[model samples]
Target chain A: NAGVTQTPKFRILKIGQSMTLQCTQDMNHNYMYWYRQDPGMGLKLIYYSVGAGITDKGEVPNGYNVSRSTTEDFPLRLELAAPSQTSVYFCASSWGMNTEAFFGQGTRLTVV
Target chain B: GIQVEQSPPDLILQEGANSTLRCNFSDSVNNLQWFHQNPWGQLINLFYIPSGTKQNGRLSATTVATERYSLLYISSSQTTDSGVYFCAVEMAGSGGSNYKLTFGKGTLLTVNP
Candidate 1:
């Protein structure tokens, strides 16, 4: 099984540029999350969706937005990317509450 | 919001040695999970122990909800086990389907062969 898949394993973005980090899962999980990991820091939640059309902000959601259009896809969008936005982005999904989460390989993003 | 802390921040152990990693959370939680992030940056789920204990091969985990702490034990460590171990938790009152996991800074483990 593919589990969770993230596109553009690596990317370089110019300041003020906008891009979308694509994430998909074949596990049919209902809960999806977007998190970013900075150097020497733990993963911080940026956004999460309980199900299709239901999205919520997480601990660090400033420069990003997420949309869950279907059960399998949860894409994160960054507008006006800044140097502070550079980090490794991870996408995760779970079947329900109190369940194990499966994470993608992650996208290493660099904002210049 | 809940805070999760893990220690020691770094550990080095020789192959065949055993080690224990600890995770402490500030508030009551409904669930706790342990993950191993390899050099390639893939978060591999190690355990989903909300309370009590569970084991898988050479790795085991225990979580005491009342005490708000969890422990991950690795037996007979190997070079392949070198990575960053993270502890994540979800607060108890996170009602509805929106479940968010708060993660600790992680404990970096280096198993020398």
Candidate 2:
């Protein structure tokens, strides 16, 4: 099973450019989350979805947007990429509250 | 907002040595987890111990909810165990609406041969 899949394992974007990080899970998890990890730092939550069509903001949500249109997909969007946004992004999914979460390989984004 | 803190920002160990990493949270939580991020940047879930202790092979974890702390123990460490260990928690929210997972800075471990 492809627990969680993230597209564009690596990407370099120019300043002001916008892009979407794609994430999909085949586990049919109800909770999905988007996080970014900076150098030598732990992952920070960007956005989360409790279920299809339900989304909420998380810590460090600035410059990022997320949508949960289906049970298997949660995509993160950067409206205006900035150098500060350059980091490794991770997508995770869990069956529900208090359950083990599965993470994607991660998307390394570089904003120049 | 909840705050999570991990001890021993960095650790160097020889193969076969054992080590323990600690995580402390500022508030009560409903979920607690440990993850190992390898050099490749893959975050692998090591344990989900909100309370009590659980062992998996050479790795084990204990969470003391009453004390708002958790411990991750690695036995007979190998070079392959080199990575960043992160502790994440979900604070208990009113009405069961908030489930945002917060992470600590993490403890970097390097096991040498």
Candidate 3:
């Protein structure tokens, strides 16, 4: 099974350019999350959604936005990409609160 | 916000040596997991033990909920074990609020042949 999947293995965005990172899960997990990993920094929660039509801001959601329109999809949008936004983005999903999370291979995004 | 702390930010061990990695959380967590990110940047599942101990091949993990700490043991380490290990936990109180995960800065392990 494709636990969790993310699109665009690598991406380069010019300053002020906007893009969306696609994430999907076939596990039918009720919980999904978005996190970014910078060099030396483990992983910081960027945004999350508990279910469809429900979204929440995480520790570092200032530069990005997320939408949970369907149970299988969660996309992160960068309105105006900046150099500081360059990082590896990971998508994860869990069946429940105390369940194990499955992560995607991740998308390496670079803002130039 | 919960704080997860991992010890020995950096470690170097010989192929035949054994090592232990520690993770301490500030608050109660209903969900705890350990992941190994290899050199190619793939996060592999290791363990999901909130309490008790679980073993897989040469890797084992123990989590004590009462003490809010966890320990990961690597036996007869191999060169492939060289990478960053991360510990993450979900707060018990985060029920339905969101699916946020708190991650530790991770411990980098380098196993020499």
For B1-113, candidate 2 gives per-residue lDDT tens digits of 78899999999999999999999999999899999999999999999888999999999999999999999999999999999999999887643335767899999999999
Which pairs clash inside model 2? none
TM-score to true structure, per model:
0.97, 0.96, 0.97
Model 2 off-target regions past 4 Å?
B94-97
Q: Between which residue pairs do clashes occur in model 3? A: none
The TM-score measured for candidate 2 stands at 0.96
Worst 10 residues of 3 chain A by lDDT: A93-102
For candidate 3, write residues B44-86 as lDDT tens digits: 9999998999999999999999999999999999999999999
Global lDDT of each candidate: 0.94, 0.92, 0.93
Error of 1 at A52 (Å): 0.5
Candidate 3's displacement at residue A93, Å, is: 0.4
Tens digits of per-residue lDDT, candidate 1, A1-112, equal 9999999999999999999999999999999999999998899989988899999888789999999999999999999999999999999999987788889999999999
Provide interface RMSD per model, one decimal. 1.9, 1.7, 1.4
Best-to-worst ranking by TM-score: 3, 1, 2
TM-score of chain A taken by itself, candidate 1: 0.99
What's the C-alpha lDDT at position A43 in model 2?
86
Clash pairs, candidate 1, are none
DockQ of 3: 0.76
